[model samples]
Target: MPAEPLEKGQTRFALRAPSARRVAVVIEGEAHPMNRDPDGLYSAEFGAPAGTLYRFRVTTGGGEELEVPDPASRFQPEDVHGPSEVVDTRAFGRPDAGWRGRPWHETVLYELHVGAFTPEGTYEAAAGKLDHLRDLGVTAVELMPLSDFPGGRNWGYDGVLPYAPDSSYGRPESLRAFAAAAHERGIQVFLDVVYNHFGPDGNYLSAYAPEFFTDRHETPWGAAINMDGRGSGYVREFFIRNALYWLSDYGLDGLRLDAVHAILDDSPEHFLTELARRVQEGPGAGRHVHLLLENEENEASRLLGGGSSDSVYTAQWNDDIHHALHVSATGEGASYYSDFADAPVARLGRCLAEGFAFQGDPSQHRGNARGEPSGHLSPLRFVSLLQNHDQVGNRAFGDRISESVSSEVVRAVAAVYLLAPQVPMLFMGEEWAASSPFQFFCDFDGDLARLVTEGRRREFQKFPEFSEEATRERIPDPSDEQTFLDSKLVWDERGDLENAEILDFYTDALAVRRAEIVPRLEGIPGTGAQQRLVGERGLRVQWPLADGSLLSLLANLSEKESGGFEPPPGRLIFATNDTGPDDTGNLSAWTVAWYLLENNS
Candidate 1:
């Protein structure tokens, strides 16, 4: 929760600065000394109403005085390095009164970055497109992070203030209105949140409260957060409260925790578990509130028996499925793709039938065991997709999967995953095969800008394609304004004949998933999915549904036709190329077919 408002328009302001000898709340250029408690918390009461701009002046133990924005600021109107503004959260009227959220089995996520989603690139602008998303069969809109970052333009990962939404998008009430607009259209809204590390710039916690971080564990960014070290209880409470604030105040339906594998904690009660328990007891108690994760470790224990009332997490982004699908479609065997290159068809089958392809298996890329057994988990616990922000933006050119493969191949892969039992997600502009590339762009200046641009190009130096200096220079600089402009989607392309056909293909597939598959997913057992390889690039997988029926998929991923397979048993529900198998038990090149077998006993 944010700072509580007291009677007579007074608000209580508090800051944890145990290492500071003196602290004062600077409101409207007037400083008021704060009283320090035994726990090292400085507190002050002021008659500051809503929209009051203030900063904290702290005198450190070394006798250095500096001003910093409130760590729990509700809104930062002037980017990260400015004064924080008090917001009246209850002023905004609710958008929808009848939105109790939908079930997890019916989630068809459309992930989008608010900046590039529309030409206006504001919360109100994005909300206007809910009709298009609803018409395209998107049940939920998974927004990239909105936390306050360093500059005007960012991917939202480099955010410093977790409580403040970047002002470049819109005001805090604008985000609340966006949620209300989504709920009116029966679309659930989910936000991506980064809890592992803060951005490199504008983080003021270490200066006043060094105990917020610990040198015990090292992360990719820096020293790990003090989750299990001394004075860790308050640190954990800060993040947990942040999560609850977004869900309760903003009326968001769900949250996607980004890269939680880096949130190292060795306490008896893991932070993740405690957060989930608090959420389930909080806002989640009244309505359906889903919690999703992005964990590279493929930890199935956190996702066991998920999407139910008693589960810790609802689902995880299944990178194994995406990697296998990308390797099979494009035949690119570089970097992490090498793990799935040799037998991409087999690996794809395993990912579709079971939850993971590397269940307790050795990962040649990492030179270690990668995952736990996930065969007993329901496929819905895995969120499957072909392209996402990291898969596309991290590339030297930020080329999408459609850029590397034929349209036929893209259609075939889309057919396979869109109808699979796993929850399906689509990257923004993917439904129409948008031509714009989602390049990595930022708005850092001076030395930081140069370092980030150089670092971006250097990351691809190990690849043979970018080994030369000339080739590396061809990669766009992350700080370039044109790079950001080039990434915006061209809405007019949807009306083009070729793009419209692709859009229609996706619409039909998602419609089938909603009408046929979502109804049978409620009580399906986790252990009944099975798979078999048909030929070199052919796969046959099936899952027994809760209603004693069977759902099956047969796919030929290669450009060559595959034979020596009997006709699949079940009534054909959807197909990419043909209606059924040929007389010689042959499936055409790049074809996918889904079937349903009814139990007539």
Candidate 2:
């Protein structure tokens, strides 16, 4: 194969596929022949190129001309999803790229949707808010997927262009600028990416590149991507290069892979295993690269590769705990609420102390046994959170769990999540209890909008509380400035009474975790040992603190019961839930009491 070049007058391009004999690059007014380079890279340069009206002319194994985007183009047209405008990824002023790489457990993650993170809702607006996260003790911010979606606004799961930051979010410059600014604040940035399925609309890859997917395999959305098919070699290369591009070209600190369980492959060791290896050898790994997954299978294999990852993806989102806690927090008896209700705090504590609950337990929802005992993995390997974006937006009205629980319970739960052995993550506005709802929002063409509105209502019709009419009505119009406005964090309310109190509680809780617990967790001891003294209304957990003491921190989960707690008679550091008339946001429900026991012996 030979590298492709612009035929006389052309402003567009296509990727080199060794299997394809002929290829053409089509810009606005002209089409050019492409030559493949020795490295299998397709090349076509234009005299003048600027906007998004670009598509490829690809000739596959069989003689045919179909249009597709430059496999890794930076920006694509809104509706066409064909070849996109070529961008100099380094065009947006590149940062010094030097960053202090922090380990997975060492990071405090703050998750935000770029579209709704600020009133401007672009990458630039988010850059302005880095100060708030820095002050809140956040060392990293994990962004929702930024790949190019169909319309001007989306949740970003239906991305078609993997190489580019969504043009709707801003230009390539804006994204690179934001990355540079974030690094300057001593904050690492992680990007979430989707590869399971190409979206329904604006997916034109099938037109030009037939080998990218396989009808032999099935996915919930459509045909599974051709990972293990005849041309699987290039297929793996396509995704692996994208992973490294974000880390090397974009200077990303980490990647949160969306729906890895859906990415099925029969290759030896697995694509995930290979992908993790390549990323660790990439640029971020020179600094360091953290890999995370949103998995439904609870498969331990992704983290078990023993690859060069900092801690083999230090943690996964603990959804079973989230489900259990959500059911306990909100009395809402809705879908998938079966396994949780009435599940004791002991069960929750066991999951926190160790990862993976439902280990061989008969799950009524799954109709089978679930999970192996995660006894051997470090506690820092599972990230636990009270509320994330999915828990909110996926709801009919997108009600936050805070709406149901008392402030005390919220504060207490926050303590368990932030102070626990695993990494802690926070959804936007959760720290201050913002009233604005983060509803399911999207913008599609008019007829497609009607289809989406109608389709969404019919899907959730079974839930008694989920009204079809209201569900349809609740889908926020993505283009509406008001919808975006409703989601921004209200920074002004930080000094108000209620929000201020929530802020103080969060700050104090964070202080305790860093000061009292982190060191002990860094060098954990024992393998597969359960330590707990259960009482009628309280529980005491005894685990060796890597710092010094054989620590036993007891908690009273029930207000109706009390017990005697004898320490080594050191200083009482802090009491979390002791709610007084003039207490500083410390309440009876969901509270913590801290102590620094001294060895007087």
Candidate 3:
């Protein structure tokens, strides 16, 4: 919720610091001490006008004084280390006031990082491009994290102040305007948020409330957040409120929680359950407020309605489908790719027909069983994608698959996910096969910059390709401005012939999905989709409709063309390679075709 500027130009301030002996609201070098309650909350009303900058002067254990930004700051116009500005989020008018968000099953998400989305990289500039996405059949724009970070350029996962929108993206209202512009074009907007751990730089929670973090468990970042430890109820409320704030204040349609697997909690009722419950019971009760999760563990229970009635998330990112497609496109079996290479096409077939490929099955790559049975769940419960931030940015060179695979492979993969029953997502520039790379870029300074650059290079030492001296030197510096500049998308190339061809493929596939597939699949309910391997690497899928008709897909995964496979006697709708029956009817190598099998009975 936004702070209310009371009458007489005084603003009420509050801080939840259980361990603080004294707290003061400092405005322009003037300090006004606050009153502490028995419940450990310190608050005071001061004669500070709206937009007045303020910071907390807290006395912690042992009487150490520290100045820090408010944990629930509505706006941080300066750097994260600077004071917070009082923002009346309600003052901004909702541009698309009549827009009620769409349902989960209707979403066709296009993910992009605002900084590298365009040259200007501001919300206004990004909003100007919504027409392109809207024309391409994108229903929503899943922005990469926009929370306040240390510097101007970042991937946004390193955000510290979760409540404040990054000043580099313009004011908070700019983001609201961006969302409204998207809504005007009939597109929904959502944000990716990081709650597992705060970034290393600009973090100040420990100074006043060290209990916000705990050593009970370890995550890849370090000690996990105090989600279920002593005094953790307050910490949980902080994040739960953050979730509601984004939806209610910015008019955002939803939120994508990053890496829920890393959020360690052992309570009887998980924090995620609590978050869902509170959101549905609070301001989001009557809205189409969707919650998406990025759970790397492939956990399906939470998504399969194991949580409370109102606590289940709409869906989760299906990395299994992406891994299978990546392995099939390029036979790179390093790291996490190893588990997906054995029978890549078969694995993809499973994901296309079912929700997960590894459901409580042993993972040869992880040396243990992974995932849970999700076949009983709806196919829309998964968000399938070809290229995303992690898949591209995690590479040693931060190269997209477009840089790695042939144009034919890109078209085939695009057709697979776009036409599948699951909700489809396209990374920015993926539609036109943009040439620019989306690298791991940042703007950290001094020792932290050096450490980040060195650590990024060192982290890849496990791979033989990155360990070599020559390859190591080729790695882009994460802290370099040039690296950040290199990641910007080139909007002019959308019309180039080669790029246009791929873009046409995406557009045509999406058009077909909207006009033909979605209505039939969503209107009627069954097992969603049924699939059978046509050959060693070919798959034939049948999606039954309400009228007993079937929408079929035939795909060839091998490089060599094979013959003698026929559709169930219906209209031939679309084809990638334009290959038909080889006198006996076969699909060409790396080709995908869709057919509408009408009910003849």
Among the numbered candidates, top lDDT falls to: 1
lDDT of 1 by residue, 433-545 (tens): 99999999999989999999999999999999999999999999999988988999999999999899999999999999998899988867888888999877999999998
Shift of residue 292 alpha carbon in model 2, Å: 0.7
Instruction: Indicate the TM-score of model 1.
Output: 0.98
Q: What is the C-alpha lDDT of each candidate?
A: 0.91, 0.67, 0.86
How close is every model to the real structure, measured as TM-score?
A: 0.98, 0.87, 0.96
Error of 3 at 169 (Å): 0.9
Residue 6 displacement in candidate 3 (angstroms)? 3.4
Sorted on lDDT, best first, the list reads 1, 3, 2
Full-model lDDT, candidate 1: 0.91
Q: Give a tens-digit lDDT track for model 3, residues 78-150.
A: 8899999988777789777788788676789999999999999999999999989998999999999988999
lDDT per residue, candidate 2, 1-601, as tens digits?
1112243433445475655667777767577787887644466666643453566677776777677666577665453364567554544455554575676656788889998888778899999999988777787889998887777667788787777778777877777778778888878889988878877677656655567888877888788988888777777887888888788767778888888778888876577777878876766456767888787776654464323332255467778767755654564546656766545566666676667666667777778877655666666667788888888877766667767777776775676567665678888878787777776667677787777667766667787655557655665554455665676666687788888888887777767766766655766643433435335334445554455544444455554434444442334444564432122322243344544443331
Ranked by lDDT, the better of candidates 1 and 2 is 1
